[model samples]
Target: MNPFRYERALDVDHAVQAASQGGRFIAGGTNLLDLMKENVERPRRLVDISRLNLDRIEPLSDGGLRIGALARNADLAGHPQVLRQYPLLSSALMAGASPQLRNMATTGGNLMQRTRCYYFYDTATPCNKRSPGSGCGAVGGCTRIHAILGASEHCIAVHPSDMCVAMAALGATINVAGPQGRRTIPFEEFHRLPGDAPQYDNTLGEGELITGVDLPAEGFAGHYSYLKIRDRLSYAFALVSVAAALRLEDDGRIAEARVALGGVAHKPWRLPDAERMLAGETPGSRVFARFADALLEGATGQGDNEFKIELACRAIVRALEQAANGTPQSQVDKRIA
Candidate 1:
C-alpha cells in the first residue's frame, strides 16, 4: 500500500472537511483498504469516520427506517425492525459475504464498494473503469461473471452490493454530506449505469460522504424473500439474485409487488413491467413464471452467460413463489441445501 496520512474524524463535518482535502473516507475498510493495497485506489490521506455518531437505526415518523451509514452490516441485517418490516433487506444482507465480514462492514461502505471485476482489480489488465482510456479487457475475455444489462462497450462489471439490491426494491434514498453541505439522492439514481462513462460508478461527487440510507415504507409487507444463486453453497457472490416483496389480497390476488435483480446488471435492475403484471393477479407458479419472463425482456447475454437469462428467470419465479406461499423452513432447507 502507498504511504498515506491518517486522520480520525470527530464528526460528519470534520469527515467532510478531511475528504475535501483529497482524502478517502474510511469506515469498515473492507473495500477501501483492499483496493488501496492492490494499487487500484491510491489516496494521499485516509479519514477514519468510524467514531462518528452515525451508527443508529432509527424508526422514522413516516413509518420507515433511517439507517445510519456507519451501521454495521450484521447489526442492520439482524435488527428486529429490519427483519420484521423489511425482510427482503435482511435476507439480502444475510446472503452476502460472511458473518465475520458483515460484522465489520458498514452500510455506506458496502454501497460504495467497487465492482469485483478481475480486470479492474489487477493492475496488469487494461480496464476503463480502473483507468479511463486504458480499454476493456473483459469485452472478449473471461466474462461469465460480467453483466448482461446496463453495460456499455467500455465496461461489463456488475454492481457487487447485495444490500443495495433490496434497497432498490424498497425505494431507499441516500443522504450525502460534502463540503458544500448535504443532499439526498434517490436510490435508483444513486448508482449510475455503465454508459459511455464507465469510469463513473455513482452520482456522488468527489469528496462527498454518504451519511445514511432512508427506506420509505410501502405496503408490500408479509410476502418477501431474497434468493441468491452461486456456484458454491455459502460465502460466494451471486450468479443471479432476486429481491422480491409482494402483497396479496384476501382473494389470493396480488395487490402490489417490488422486484429487483443483481449479478446480471451494472446496477440493481428493477422491473416495473413485471411488478405491473403481478398486480391484481393470482399468485401462482404460472403467473410468477410469466412475470419473470416479462422482467427478462431485452436482456442481452454474452456467449458463456447466455444460460444466465434462463437461470435468472427461474430464480425470480422461485423467489416469488416462495414469498407467495410462505414455504415451510424444512422444505426451503431441503431445496437450497
Candidate 2:
C-alpha cells in the first residue's frame, strides 16, 4: 500500500471539509483497504469518518428507517427493527460475507465497494475500469462472473453488493454530505451504468461523503426474499442473486412488487417491467417465469457465463415464490446449485 496521511474526523462537518480538500473518507476500510493493497486506489490522505457519530439506525415518524452510513452490517442485519420491518434488507445483509467481515463492514462502505472483476483487481491485466482506455480484458477473456446487463464493450464488471440489491428493491435513498451541502440521491440513481467511462462506478461527486441511507415507509414487510447463487455455499461472490419483495391483496393478487438482481449489471438491476407485470397478477411459477423471461429480454452473456441468463431467470422465480409463500430462506441455509 502507498504511504498516506490519516486524520480522524471529529464530526460530519470535519469529515466533509477534509474530504473536499482532496482526501478519501475511510469508514469500515473493508473495501478501500483492499483496493489500496492492490494499488487500485492510491489516496495520499484518508480522513477517518468511523468516529463521526453516524452509526445509529433510527426509526422515522413515517414508519420508515434511517440507517447511518457507519452502521455495521452485522448490526443492521441482526437488529430487531430491521428483521421485523425490513427483513429483505436483513436477509440481504446476512447473505454477504462471513460473520467476522460483516462485523467490520459498514453500510456506506458496502455501497461504495468496487466490483470484484478479476481484471480490475489484477494490476498486471489491462482493464478499462482499472485504467481507462487501456482496453478491457474481460471482454475477450474469462467472463463467468462479469455482467450481462447495462454493460458496454469497455467493461463488463458487475457490482458485488448484496445489501445494495435489497436497498434498490426497497427504494431507499442515499444521503451524501459534501462541501456545497448535503443532498439525497435515489438508490437506483446513485449507482451509474458502465457507459463510455467504465471507471466511474456511481454518481457520487468528488469529495462527497455518504451520510446515511433512508428506507421508505412501504418496505413490503412480510413478503420478501434474498436468494444468492454462488459457486460455493458460502464466502463466495454471487453468480446471480435475486432480491424479491411483494405485497399481495387479500385475494392473493399482487398489489405491489419490487425485484432487483445482483451480479448481473454494474448497478443493482431492478426490473420495473417485471414488477409492473406482477402487479394485479397472482404470484405463481407460470407468471413469475414469464416475467423473469421478460426481465432477461436484452441479457446477453460472454462466453463462459452464458448459463447465467438461464440461471438468473430460474433464480428470479425461486426468489419470488419464496417471498410470496412467506418462506424466506434462513441466513444459515445455503442453497447449492
Candidate 3:
C-alpha cells in the first residue's frame, strides 16, 4: 500500500472540512482499504470519520425512518424496528457481505462502494471508469456480469451494492453535507447512469459528504421482499436481484407497487412501466409475466449472459408474488452448479 497521512475527525464539520482537502473519507474502510491495497485507489490523505456522530436510527415524524451514514450494516440490519418494519431492506443487507464485513460496513460506505467488474479492479486492464479515455475492456471481454440497462459506449459495469437496490424500491432519499451546505437527493437520482462519463458513478459533487439515508414510510409498510439470485448460496453478488413492495386492494387487486432491480443496470433499475402494468391487476403468474415482459423491453444482453434476462424477470415475478401473498420466505432457488 502507498504511504498516506491519516486524520481522525472530531465531528461532522471537521470530517467534511478534512475531506474537502482532497482526502478520501474512511468510515468502515471495507471497500476503500481493499482498493488502496490493490493500488486501484491512491489518496494522499485519509480522513477517518468513524468517530463522528452519524450512527443513529431514528423514526421520523412523517412516519419514515432516518438512517445515519455511519451506522454499521449489522446494526441497521439487525435493528428490531428495521427487521419488523422494513424487512426488504434488512434482507438485502443480510444477503450482502459476511457477518464480519456487515459489522464493519456502514450505510454511507455501502452506497458508495464501487463495482466488482474485473476490468475496473485490475489496474493493468484499460477501463474508462478507472481512467477516462483509457477505453473499456469489459465491452468485448468477459461481460457476463456487465450491465444490460443504462449502459453507455464508455462503460457497462453494474452497480454492486445490494442496499441501494432496496433503497431505490423504498423511495429513499439521500442527505448530503458539503462545503456549500446540506442538500437532499432522491435515491433514484443519487447514482447516475453511465452516459458519457462512466467514471462518475454518483451525483455527489467533489468533497461532498453523505450524512444519512431517509426512507419514506409510504407503501410497503406491510408486505415487501428482496430476492437475490446468484451463482453461490451465500457471499456472492447477484446475477439478478429484485426488491419489491406491494399493497393489495380489498378485492385482492394490486393497489400500489414499487419495483427496482440490481445486477442488470448501471444503477438500481426501477421499472415504472412494470409497476403501472401491475397496478389494479390481480396477483397471478400471467399478470406477473406481463409486467416482467414490459420491464425487459429493449434490454440488450451479451451472448454468454442472455439467460440473466429471463432469470431477472422470474425473480421479479416471484418477489412480487411473495410480497403480495405475505410470504416471508421466497421459494425461488439459487443454484448455478
Q: Please give each candidate's TM-score.
A: 0.96, 0.98, 0.96
For residues 1-337, what per-residue lDDT tens digits would candidate 3 score against the true structure?
A: 9999999989878888888888889999999999998898899999999988999999999988999999999999888888877888888898898899999999999989899999989999999998999999898888889887778889989999989999999889999999899999999899999899999989998789999999887737577878888887778888898888988898989988888999999899996766888888888888988888887778888666778888888888888877877874442343311
Model 1 CA deviation exceeding 4 Å by range: 328-334
Q: Could you tell me the lDDT of residue 170 within candidate 1?
A: 93
The candidate that achieves the highest lDDT relative to the unseen native structure: 2
Give Cα distance to truth, residue 320, candidate 1, Å. Answer: 0.7
* Local distance difference test, candidate 1: 0.87
Please, what are the lDDT tens digits per residue for candidate 1 over residues 263-284?
Answer: 9988999977668988899888
Clashes in model 3: which pairs?
A: none
Q: Tell how far residue 224 is off in model 3, in angstroms.
A: 1.7
Per-candidate clashes, comma-separated: 0, 0, 0
lDDT score for residue 95 of model 1: 83
Residue pairs with backbone overlap in model 1: none
The TM-score leader among the candidates is 2
Model 1 scores worst on lDDT over the 10 consecutive residues at 328-337
Q: Looking at candidate 2, what is the lDDT of residue 228?
A: 94
Model 3 earns a TM-score of 0.96
Clashes of 3: 0
